[model samples]
Target: MRPRLLFASAAAVVAALTAATAPSATGAPRAAAAAWDSDLAAAALSANPAAATASGSQSPELGPGAAFDGNGATRWSSNAADNAWLRVDLGETLRIDRVTLDWEAAYGKKYVLEVSGDGTNWRPFYTEDAGTGGTVTAHTYPQEVRGRYVRLRGIERGTPYGYSLFSFKIYGGTPAPASTTRANLALHHP
Candidate 1:
């Protein structure tokens, strides 16, 4: 009886260690899921004025428009399908240097980030085969990817439900710095 008790305790310790290292149903580890990529990236270009669309919305309230509305409370959710996708159209063609995915509870296990100029022809800039699904920031510098339309094509769903995103933010050119000069140009009386 004493030996059985000792063996049970050893088994429990091994099980705990295995669970800690194993990938959860969410796809990646908890640490990677909680943080963004460590890089000083560019600002998001797909905010207001940008139109968003998707393959299929889970419901009227969870439309693709909610993803780019700049509201954390709102989100875009697709129907329960692995092929569901979300797309955003920047008003003009711009160099894409970074992208951030603020995923909801239902995330994508495998997805491809593509950019296109004509909206028909797409070129993948980033491919996420293993996603943990929290806030993922991807930098595409030196790849020279430029496009007006950016999209995330879901190849595999992380949850039984479809893919969902709070924000599908695209990043590009450097943001302008604030003026340091204290003198006001409009103050001239000449």
Candidate 2:
């Protein structure tokens, strides 16, 4: 009876350790799920032209606008380079929650999602080193991240072609007006 009790205790300890170190369904560390919030970023504006700049576009029609046009059939393709990237401006500082990327056949296998208040400074929000191609990927933040700009920096392309996106969606947070006028305040208050 004493030996049985000791064996049971050891078994429980091994189980606990295995569970603690297990990988999640997404093939990411269990801790990665804790860093993500399930909320979507639909309220965001594309803000690509005024707030965004890219490494390069394949053509005018296939430029950044194609990715934000809300049509899944059209896409934006970049020049065949590992360093190509696309950015979107939220116009004002917002609590960013999620980002969805609809990839074309030409996708990014290694990339980083970053945020910035000023276009020049950037901080990584998420990273995917073994990304699968031709899929819609959504990344959510566990906590609110305040920023004006979001960028997808491609480090490795999945195909001989450059990185291509069918649609890029940013969601979450309220859009802050640059300045509020007295009339606007009165209208809401009244």
Candidate 3:
């Protein structure tokens, strides 16, 4: 019975992976659901690589990619604009639970953490009006939002310079199908 159960579990995993990797009707590859404990912002994920972009950079060296590079020494600095913003493409739509903003000397006094399915339309999940800089961790736990693109829009600058960030880390889980979710819930409940 143990061997049979093992084989059944393996088969289920394989089928789930296959379905998750399949392309959608729109011809765009589907966003694979990731483990709830994993960091969705990590570029190391070969399946869905995350990328970062910004409205404007202070210089070529301090580009947007530096913020998501997982290197503390590097950072992304925006130009002198109160409305400067930084966005990250999570490669797949995810249920974002939390976000950590490691700010540099220059930070946003008033900013909004927004999520979007398309890059054009955005919905704010977190807003900081009295930002003291440093590191800010915003948890959307009880009420998580879903989107592929996450943006940090600055409304007011904390410093005389522009907004700067050492890192913009995102934490989320991939959404499961209704059937899979129900099955898991039933298994645990029973």
Candidate 4:
């Protein structure tokens, strides 16, 4: 019985992976989902491979990707007008407690971090009208949240200019990273 159960589980995993990886009706949507799922699945694999193998929702890659590098907030473009925002759909639920914004280019320095249970509605984790250093310092907003959608609203650019990006990451887990910070309070870029 035990052997049969293992065999069944293995088979199911293989089937699921195949199905999830399969191409959908349209190329773009399917590709996006596959890409997002792949990233989440990849992250989970390192944390827990077996759990990664078992979980679904490895579809929908509606998120941003980094191109070049920035020494300090120098990569974000200032072209985003009002309501013209970029967002990240992590593609799965994560127990996120903190979000760190590291801008290498130093242009899109000051930012606001918002988290949502559903992508449609978001609450602030950190907000800044004016930001601080354009260098390599981590601006952290600490909160206990389980969300699939995380968004960064670029309030103001570092050095009063907006550029592009190199990489944007969402760091999370149980109990959260060991740190001290206030809840939902506005902070300046230092």
Best by TM-score: 3
Judged by whole-model lDDT over C-alpha atoms, candidate 2 comes out at 0.71
On the 0 to 100 scale, the lDDT of residue 185 in model 2 is 31
lDDT of 2 by residue, 15-78 (tens): 7547756887887865311112332222233323444457899887788766766778888899
Cα lDDT, all candidates: 0.75, 0.71, 0.83, 0.44
lDDT by residue for model 3 over 46-165, one digit each (tens)?
333337788999998998887877778999999999999999888768889899999999989999999999989999999999999999999996776999899999999998899999
User: Among these predicted structures, which one has the highest lDDT?
Assistant: 3
| Superior candidate under lDDT, 3 versus 4 | 3
Query: lDDT per residue, candidate 4, 23-136, as tens digits?
Result: 766753332222321234235333442321101111222123331121233233434332224455555666564544544444454566677777778877666666564333
Indicate the residue-level lDDT of 94 in model 4: 66
lDDT pick, better of 1 and 3: 3
How high is each candidate's TM-score? Answer: 0.66, 0.65, 0.75, 0.46
Task: Mark the regions of model 4 whose C-alpha exceeds 4 Å error after superposition.
Answer: 1-63, 67-84, 133-142, 174-190
Candidate 2 Cα outliers beyond 4 Å, as residue runs: 1-49, 175-190
Order of the predicted models by TM-score, top scorer first = 3, 1, 2, 4
Greater lDDT among 2 and 4 belongs to 2
**Candidate 3 all-Cα RMSD:** 5.9
